[model samples]
Target: MSFTCSDCGKGFTRSSSLQRHQSVHTGERPFTCSVCGKGFTRSSHLQAHQSIHTGQKPFTCSYCGKGFTGSTDLLAHQSVHTGEKPFSCSDCGKGFSRSFSLQRHQRVHTGERPFTCSMCGKGFTRSGSLQTHLRFHTGEWPFTCSDCGKRFTRSSDLLAHQLVHTGKMLFSCSDCGKGFTRSFSLQRHQSVHTGEKPFTCSVCGKGFARSSHLQTHQSVHTGGKLFTRSDCGKGFTGSTDLLTHKRVHTGETV
Candidate 1:
């Protein structure tokens, strides 16, 4: 017998599955995390979240040696080694390793911004994006670097920053043999050989290999100096220009 959700009319194989589906409409989260007081619809989700507090990653990836608190996360990480993307978008034909990532990507085509910031009323495609946006209003930088004591709003930013202290260039260009701490940097470097400019400006129709370069180029049309020095109050179009200007004050020779 097929069980159906009353609210959404979604069919389920079992009554238990239907009950779980009802929680989405009811906004009911019975399981609560003791450490952070975060709520989850399922006990397994709560257990998975608890590992964040304990720092206990029992599930280790056989391919990369990376540890994950949950088996589902480990399965997702394994896709990186296998190059397997089971979840695919019907709209744009983009493949994703995880279902959650595919759902987030679908929002881009649908223009569905379900998650919204409470402070600024800005909409985001994913909850993680909303959480990161909320951090700016709350002045919360949860991720910290041990080497430099620098704080970042996102864990990915912290991970990228830590590579600077370690001098670890994990990503390398096949064309030029140049190394980069981030994969996007290597991708940008490869564009020099391929002559691919993916990021295009709406104003002047100028193409750039990197998004940062495109943003810097956009400032030329708007006449906006985004990066500013606190000491002299002088502004620059790009971060590299701002860093170069700082050397005048420090008297640093390069």
Candidate 2:
């Protein structure tokens, strides 16, 4: 006999399944994972949660040979190779492989920042992003590069930094055929060919391809002397000014 949940109107083959489904509405989680103290509505969900502690990934992708703890995770990973976006954003029409990813991306259009830092009033779109941002306040550099002994708060940052030590330029510009270690660097280089000056100076309205160039241009307006002559004790705005000033001592008027 089939059992049906009155609250959700969902049919289940077993009475146990119906009982488990009712727990969702009742806000009851009888089964709990001992490792992480995570509550689950059913024993099967608790069993699946235990795999996280055991590091057991039974599901393997046939396309890329990647392993996942669950079939749901494996199916999501397979979408990358197939280019199948099952989930889409209603606001921006952008597609994502996972529903959770689509939910996170939708926050961009909604301007909803659910995650916030406790130390500061700063907010982030994702909880993971907020955790990473907290490292700046905590001064926590947990992820370390084995090659260069350099440390970063996020593992992704360390992985990107490792590419610099390897000297491997995977991303290349099609216009100039110039290569870059990162895709962002390639995108910035491509802007040069497109003549897309995104960064603009507020003082003089001078446009620059890179933000660093705009920052250097802003130094001209700051009236702060960065370079100082050791011999004459005179201050200059830039290194070039210091070099030009040094010629007075050497008597080289070239």
Candidate 3:
């Protein structure tokens, strides 16, 4: 007695579930936000969105004291404290706290790029990645640091930059007592002790500790100088190398 979606052939236990699922294929959004005029397929989605205008967050996380408009968001946030990853990737066996994160990670294995940039036509696995890529073309730096007035495209970059102003080294390496502003930096630093060169060049079979190093090394094989200086017409394999070379003209000390 299960109801099936005619559009996608998806089975649902209830007829109401099938009707709601049909909206995905039909592009039907019966519920509309009064404030922003945003369309939603479900009334619950509209109600959750209305919180943005009303500034109401009833659901609060007990672990972090973070407020969310919906219970589902709070439940997902709670996983951070519990360290529970309910969703697991079938291809890589990597666990993600959110199902959407798991879905995005699956694209790495499948090589599926659904989101494409309208200006450059560059494909991305996630919509957020495409949005960030579009920012480069638009020259939009939305996130700004309050202290130094430094601007960044993403909020995470801004947060990491803020650590520089505070002079806070939260992550430390156990191997050499080296401190890092970010956890990722600490992880990369720890690789030096382990001698782990995970990123390998397909052309030369040379391994690198970081992916950026491997990308730069690949340019040597292709004889491509992607980053070029305008003042001296000096070409470099990597952006960092070109940036370092620019200091000679600027007379800036590192």
Candidate 4:
């Protein structure tokens, strides 16, 4: 004999299971976790939720010795070691180990940023990334270095900055072999080798390797003198020209 749900016409082997299933339709969750106050329909579901707060993972992977809260999660972790990418993106054909990961990656192609910041109205692909970005607006630096007491918003940024204290430069330019603390600096160095001048002046249509150089060059067309001589009250367009003019009074060799 099977217990049936009148609301959804679903049959259950036990009356208790049918009663638990009915809670899904009624949105009634009796079992609640004390730690997080999260409600669940079944006691077993509430037990699993408690494990997240307790940091208790009972299931262990046989291959890599990785721990998970459930046997299904343990099986999922094992797929990474096996190099099994079962889930694939329909738009770009990119493979992922998990179906949820693939669904998240698909949002990149769809331009669907579900996670949004309430303060700035900025959208992010992941909720965790948005949470980290919120630290910038709140001026919260949680991660701190024990060595210098330097603070950072994320743990990854703190780890990278710690390499500076050790005098370690992992990123290097291929052309000049000059090392840099960050990959963004190494990429900018590589542009010099390729002779790539991305920044340009709008008024004169002049190109420059950097935005700062372009900004300085734009001052030439502004018809305003920024540098002034204190002795003669003479004005110059650039600081270098004013410094050269002051050499007449200082008696310095040019």
Candidate 5:
């Protein structure tokens, strides 16, 4: 594919560079690796692949003293230490660990269901995220807790639940010393420090950690009557809450 350079009308020799230059026309990842079956858009990435096999960590961060195989990875890691989130969600003020994560999250706002589940009508922005969600309906427990032997569908969920037992707060906010098990929890906790209630109630000004929480809060303002047990007069926000609350009365723990 011979093409004229937009800069000086000079013709480029290689077709691959021409395609990458025209990723301006359509974003494409043509270059692929045989070993890991990973795809890349450029030859430089294929060369970078050698570092993973060679176990060569060339980049070192001064702040956190972390090593990375690539300088780009090191730079991205440094962003975590600096708390510099350049990319943000347009729909919500929620921040992300990386720009790619922010981009993936934007799909949630746009309702762009690109990654559809093969098993069901469900769709997601990222493939791995969809894979994680599928485990819930499938009743598949791949990760089990060592302490209590309680199984979890997703690795992150298992990790978070393990914290309940171990009390391991890995993610902590610098502004406030409040620590959380997961990065997401720490992020939500930071909102408390900043007094930034990003997600507000549509019916009321009440803010919550999640949209579901906001919905539950709205139900209260709407004066929506929640169902109570026939035998018990105990109140609950929803059926799920009522079911869980019933467990307490029944002396059941899962």
Candidate 6:
């Protein structure tokens, strides 16, 4: 007998197939992996899951030594070497390595917020993205480094921190052949070669590649007009500012 999905008019020959199909609707994954204890609804998923256990990044690039778990991931990683973006969105001409990334990128245009935070009123287009943001408020550093006791809020942060000890530079430039600790740092480091200042301040005509630098530049306005005391050379704005400023004179810096 065939198992019929009463909810969607879809039918499957096997009960196991029907059960696995239903999980997609309910967003439920009951099948658990023994190695990582990660759960998946499909057996093929469990097969693909095993690669992470062996650290088998067999998918190697022709141009770079960077390896990836899946072939598609290798293709994604290759785009960095050639700057060749094949997956272009028809909606925005915004390219991505995978179709899912293009779909996610489309959300920036449509302003769709599918994932909502239960603890707060905030929303996000992606569940993983919302998970990263929720970590900020909880002060929970779930990702830990095996080398060091340092903890980070995001997996990417932990990965970057690990580079300090591992000395493995995956992303490198073809022009200069210089490697960087993190991808963002490499992107910034490339600006020196290309002379690109993407981040700009609205307050002043001055521009910077990093937002933190722009923020510090904005403080220049508030940084000035600060009243400082003589001899100790303390600075403040108002009476309350002066009072709190007294804490430094009271040997708080020590």
Which scores better on lDDT, 4 or 6? 4
Model 6 residue runs over 4 Å out of place are 1-53, 81-83, 137-139, 167-180, 184-254
TM-score of 4: 0.41
What lDDT tens digits, residue by residue, belong to model 3 across residues 1-254?
99998865879999999998787555567998776455677899899978976879999998778899999888887886898999998876879888877976676556567666565454566555656656655657777789978778775678788888888887788888988877678878988899977667778789888755875787888887766676788888765687688789989766
Tens digits of per-residue lDDT for model 1, 1-254? 99987765879999998998677655577898776555677899889878876889999998879899899999987987999999989976768889878976676556566666565455566555666656654657777788878878776678788889988999888877888988767866888999977667888888887655776887888888766677898988765687688789989655
Q: What is the lDDT of candidate 6?
A: 0.67
- The predicted structure with the larger TM-score, 1 or 2, is 1
Better of 1 and 5 by lDDT: 1
Tens-place lDDT per residue, model 5, 1-254, is 57776743656778756656664233345766665444455767766765654667778899977677677677778877889878778777867657877976775456465555454444455555555655543545676788989876665677699789887888878986778887778877776767765457656678676544654576678765344554577655554576577677789786
lDDT value, candidate 2, whole model = 0.71
Model 1 regions more than 4 Å off: 1-46, 49-55, 173-254
Model 5 score (lDDT): 0.65
Whole-model Cα lDDT per candidate? 0.76, 0.71, 0.76, 0.72, 0.65, 0.67
Best by TM-score: 1
Question: Which candidate model has the greater lDDT, 5 or 6?
Answer: 6
Q: Which wins on lDDT, candidate 2 or candidate 6? A: 2
Candidate 1, run of 10 with poorest lDDT: 119-128
lDDT of 5 at 102: 90
Cα TM-score of candidate 3: 0.55
Taking every candidate in turn, the Cα RMSD to the unseen true structure, in Å, is 7.0, 13.7, 7.2, 16.0, 9.9, 10.7
Error of 3 at 145 (Å): 3.9
Clashes of each: 0, 0, 0, 0, 1, 0
Q: List the residue pairs that clash in candidate 5.
A: 22-25
Better of 1 and 5 by TM-score: 1
Which pairs of residues collide in model 6?
A: none
- In terms of lDDT, which candidate is stronger, 1 or 6? 1
TM-score for each candidate, following the candidate numbering: 0.58, 0.48, 0.55, 0.41, 0.50, 0.53
